[model samples]
Target chain A: MAFLELDQLSAFYGKAQALHNVSLSVASGEIIAIVGANGAGKSTLLDSIMGLTRVTGQIRLEEKSLIGLSAAGIVRSGVGYAPERFNLFPYMTVRDNLLVGAYTARNNVSDNIAVVHKLFPRLQERANQETSTQSGGERQMVSLGRALMTSPRLLLVDEPTIGLAPKVCNEIAVALKRMRDELGATIVITEQNANFAMTLAERLYVLESGVVKAEGTVDELRNDERLTAAYFGH
Target chain B: MLQIIVQGLLLSGLYALIAMGFTLIFSVGRVLNLAYGAYLLIGGYIYFTVSQTLGVPKVLGLLLAAMVGCLVGLLKYRLLVKPLKGNHVAVEISTLILAVVVQAGVVFIYGDSSKILLPIVPGVTQVAGASVTYNLLAATIGSWAILFALYWFVRKTHVGRAMQAVSMDTKGAAISGVDPDRINMFTWGLSGMLGATAGVFFASYTQLSPSMWVAPLIIAVAVVIVGGIGSIIGTLIVAHIIGFMEVLAVAVIAPELRGVFTMLLIIGVLVIRPQGLFGREEL
Candidate 1:
């Protein structure tokens, strides 16, 4: 049985349909990447799963259906989503931001933070500094660390390397891979960086204009010339 | 001169207590509960009815007043705030109307006459040629205790931290598995309790009247506007600033122009720096 599965997922913002009948499944400890251009419904798919948008579909995590749950509720049921904007508390310290993520794990806050810091040590180094003063790359780490503090079994990450340097992007990818290897977290990443996404994921879902255009192993998708031409078309 | 300092310190403590409730509602919920003043009025009347009218114990009366205030705050959230939801203007206007309506209701029952309340702890002590009532001293002590406790709770406790989280970013806090709604509800209740507690002392200091709420309400607003929104330490500091300004005006300058300086300070501060003196970081 798949650890995280989406069945015919559809979402709408006003009259505009943001996602249309999107479906995918991922087993535990697996990494999947969704690649698309801007406005290609990449972020919308992750938002739909996190219950941030008006979604109609079955999102099951470890056999439990996650439709109609609130964002807070979905998060409590071991689901995490980190967007490019990161949504960190600028007024709070890095430590407090992570604690807010571990709100459900009241007794295990310090332990969860320890695991997160081990995954990304920069967070521990800047634990006491106000998040507003941190650099963009460091804030990205904070966003990622905050998501991990929940001890999530399934994580949806949207455009984690949007404006970061290549080295930082590689670090992000490595950290995400570590999240999968160490925490046994199933990751579904959405990105516009097709090349990097291709290298990172074992499987790929190619999206265009709110629809899944192709789905296959990275090697198969990389070999398809027609899909590649259409995927990055201006 | 000595009188001004003594009066300022004592009055500032009470002012901080009053502003704390108003600040909590503004911070966590982000909507100014315009009827916040009415909480003080209602709390005062409740204490009066329980302790003075019925001749019950003062401590029990205080407790009952706080509980009633808590209930009123919760009801306001469910009935007015929750129903209106995203429309901040509607909530503010509705609460203003509710405050007026409540004042009228109080007039209907208690009459328009102001009644002097006996001190909760009667007697006075002289310090440096300045007279200090034991009642005001108790209020100051109580205010300090409440402020300390609140600071500790927000800094240390899990639920309190959730309140802090909601104040910062509601959506982020929600996604982080903190229930913004529940935390908001709790904040409203706590705000009410604090407002009511402050009300009891305020009434004893001045006198009980339906229109008595306006003064404290203005002070609460001034604390936030002058000090900055969502900063607990800022609230405390600005409460003192306003308290001393008012005291100094009455003593050194003119009693008639006491409020005039405060108005000038508001205009100057707002025109100069709108965010506040301490800025918007939550204490």
Candidate 2:
């Protein structure tokens, strides 16, 4: 069995459905990407996994059910999610933001913070600065660093490259690779940037209006005409 | 002028205590707990029952009041807040009604007439030619001490940082593995204890009556409005502003005009900067 499994998952916001009958499996230590346009249910899938939204169907982590757990409970179960909106507490200093992320794994805070600071050294330099005053790329770094502070085994990062310069995006890609290679964290990223996704992800899933349209290894998915045109910028 | 300054400082300390609990709920829980004033009412009555009627030690009575207040806060969250499902308007209206119900309950037990509480510390001293009651002085000292302690707790503690996280963004806090529900629960209880402690001092400052909750509620609202919601330093600074304004109005202007300036100040701030002096504009 895969380390994490989602079977026939359907998610809703109020009465409106955002995802329909979506299923995926993820093995340990593998990096996967879900690429889609805005409002194509990419973030919702991550939200469903994080237990941030109402869902029907099964989400199992290590064969244990995660359907009814709260978001905090899901995080405690060793999943860290960096949302697209960069939800770093605006008024809090970057250091405090990182500290709060270790709420579930309080004992390993110093070690986790050290790892995050190493991954994103800019965060350490601006540790005392409030997040509100930070630039867009810096804020994204804080979001990713804060997620790393949770010391999660499975990390879900949504739209990490959005609104960022290519240089910062490369920096993030390198950090994510280090997190996977050195820290042994299994990463699942959702991206609108298909080229960026293909660079880091071992496998790719293309989502269109809440359903997975095509999925395969990056080389195999490149052969599909529609995906090549829409996502690969053909 | 000396008397006004002295009186204003003492009064400002008490006002800071009174408004602190309300501000905490507003900031952390994102709810306007209209029944916050009822906490003071319950505290005063509880202290009166234990200390005056039952002849218990004053300190014990104060502690009992705080304990009861904490229990009431927990109950309010579990019963009223949770069931309401965070519809802030409904919670606000329900709490307002709850305050009225509590007032009626107080009237049923204590009767309509106001009661004068004996001073916690007896005697008066002249401070730079100004007459100062030892009781008010002690209350002021205690209030400042509690406020300082609270400041430390919020800034330097894990749970307090969690509270700040929840206040900023509930979803983000939860994503960080900080349970917003638990934080909200703890905040309500702590706010209750603060309110109850402030109640004892406030009642001693004035007189205990069924209608006593109204003035504090108004004062809390005024402080929150002018200072900015959810800011401790803002609350303290604005408390001093209003306290001094009231004292000056009473001493120099007319006593009847004491509250008029506070009301005008609120209106002026609202008109000039609606987000308040320190508050960030909602995103």
Candidate 3:
């Protein structure tokens, strides 16, 4: 069985359907990317896996069913999600926000915090500063740093590089790679920036209007003329 | 002037305790728990019944009242608030109705007459020429101790940090593996425990009756409104402001005017800065 599998997944916000029979799988210790436009259900797909949205689907992680689990439950089950909006508690210090992320992983809190600080050294410098006062890049670092504190086997990040400077984006890309290489974590990222996704993801899935339109290795997807024109804009 | 200062300081301490409990629920849950006053009513009556009637030790009675209040809070969250989660209006109205039901229940058992709650520590002392009871003095000291403890808890502990995170952003906290539901439940229980403890002191300070909840509810509301939402320091400061204002009005102006300035202050704050003096900016 694949490490993480979504079988015929359908999601909804109230009566409005978002994802329709979306099926996909991710291997263990691999980095995958989902690329799409605004409202193309990329974030919705991640939200479904996190149990933030109503869904009728089978989301299996490590042969265990993740359906009907709460968002916190999903995290405890070793799936960490860093949402697109970078949802750090505005009033809390950066360190406190990261500590809260380790709420379920109390046994190794100090170790995980040290790991996060190493991954994003900027977070350590601003440990006492409130997240609300941080810059966009700094806040994004805090968002990902907080998720790292969860010590998840599968880390799902949505739009990790949106509104970020090129230098900061490179820093994040390096950190994410280190997260996989050093931590042995399976990583999944959703992005609108196709180039950034291509550089980091070995395999890619194209989502459009809540359905998986295409999936392949980075090289295979890059060579397809129809896809390049429509999505990659070559 | 010394009398007013002494009286204001003592009364502010009590007000701070009363408002702190209400503020915790409001800040964390982001929902007004109108039935919050009912916790105090239940607390006062429980203390009266356990200590006064059953001849239980006063400390044990206080502890029992706190435990019962905590249970009521948990039950209210599961039965009342959870079912009506998204519809804040429904939850609020239901809480208001629950408060009335609680009042009716109290009337059924205790009858309509008000009962005097004997001082937990029975004595009187002169403090800088102002007459004070040991009961009120203990209440003030106890309130300060509890407030300091709460401050430390919110800043220092893991669960307390989770509560702060949930208060600031529920969804964010949830995604971070801090279960918002569990945090909210913990907050409700703590708020209930605090309310009940305050009630014991408040009932001793005045008299216990089915209708006593109204005055404290009004005081809590005033403190929350003037202090701004989700700020412990704001609640403490505003409670002191309201406390001193009431003392001054009663001592200098007229006894009936005690609440008049409080009302005006609320209106003035609403008109001038609706967010509150220490209100957090839109999250």
Candidate 1: tens digits of C-alpha lDDT, residues B98-212: 9999899999999999998899999999878899999998999999999999999997777887888888888778778888889989998999999999999999998999999
* Per-model RMSD to reference: 1.6, 1.8, 1.7
Candidate 1 CAPRI category: medium
DockQ scores of the candidates = 0.75, 0.68, 0.71
Q: Write the per-residue lDDT of candidate 2 for residues B142-232, one digit (tens) a residue.
A: 9999999999888778888889988888888999999899999999999899998889999988889999998889888888888776788
Q: Whole-model lDDT for model 1 versus the true structure? A: 0.88
lDDT of 3 by residue, B67-86 (tens): 99999999999899988998
lDDT tens digits, residue span A57-148, model 1 = 78899889988888889998998878778888888899888888888767777788888888788889888998999988888888888888
Ranking by lDDT: 3, 2, 1
- Lowest summed lDDT across 10 adjacent residues in model 1 chain A is found at A225-234
lDDT against the true structure, each candidate: 0.88, 0.90, 0.90
Model 1 clash pairs are none
True contacts kept of each: 0.76, 0.77, 0.87
Q: Output DockQ, candidate 3.
A: 0.71
Off by over 4 Å in 3: A229-234, B281-283
Model 2 Cα shift for residue B112 (angstroms):
0.8
- Model 2 stretches with alpha carbons more than 4 Å out: A229-234, B281-283
Off-target runs (Cα >4 Å) in candidate 1 are A225-231, B281-283
Each candidate's TM vs. the true structure? Answer: 0.96, 0.97, 0.97
